[model samples]
Target: MKEQYMITHEPPNPVDYNNLRLEGGMSGKSREASEEGLKNSLFVVCVYDEETFIGMGRVIGDGGTFFQVVDIVVKPGYQGQGLGKLIMEHIMNFLEKHTYPDSYVSLIADGSADKLYKQFGFSYTYPKSRGMYRKY
Candidate 1:
């Protein structure tokens, strides 16, 4: 049989994005915010099972000086099937083409997911620098 998965370089619609975030055990975003945020993304990778959006990852930032890997999520049913890494592969390709030596790339890994990020050369920035955030 042919493969059932399709990877596309496109962002999910706002509603799908919010629903997938919740399905993936992450916080949901408002439609307006999701729309605007996605519109500004430098690159996006979306995975679909046939036609249903199941996983996605994105790179967002000023496009030159800084970049952040975010919204890396796969549905609970789709986790552990290599979908996350597949998504990262696409994001890494985009970064490899666009980022420069001075560009800073970062992501805030959650729980055991840090291990996955480490596979992509991400390391903890503690002791020397810590991550702090104020969510509105």
Candidate 2:
């Protein structure tokens, strides 16, 4: 049977976001943090299997010059179903429609996930620049 899912240009609720993240092998965030983050995102895309949130991705930045793709995740059971690509496609569409020529769009690809981002034109920056992050 073919599974049916709906993609929307909406941010998932805090609970759904955290649940999807955890189920997708990413760390969960506090409800407060998730709420704040979703509210601040420049753009968000969510995938649902009927009423069940199954995946999500969001773009965050100053809305100009610098935009980062974050929280790209799909539920474990839905991982191999091309939902990740669907999420990225929506994100890339937003970037294309809203970003300027000099804008710097980036993402920190974990593990083999870089391969997925590469299909959307993300390239390695290691030779000329390195990605660094700090956790508080």
Indicate which candidate wins on TM-score: 1
Q: Give the per-residue lDDT of model 1 (tens digit) for 1-136.
A: 1267998987889999999999998998999999999999999999999888889999999999999999999988878988888889899999999999999999999989998999999999998999999998
lDDT of each: 0.92, 0.90
- RMSD to true structure for each model, in Å: 1.5, 1.4
TM-score of 2: 0.95
Among all windows of ten consecutive residues in candidate 2, which has the lowest summed lDDT? 1-10
My TM-score estimates for the predictions, one after another, are 0.96, 0.95
Write candidate 2's Cα lDDT for 1-136 as tens digits: 1367888887888988888888888887999999999999999999888888888999999998999999999888778889889889899999999999999999999989998998999899999999998875
- What's model 1's lDDT at 114? 95
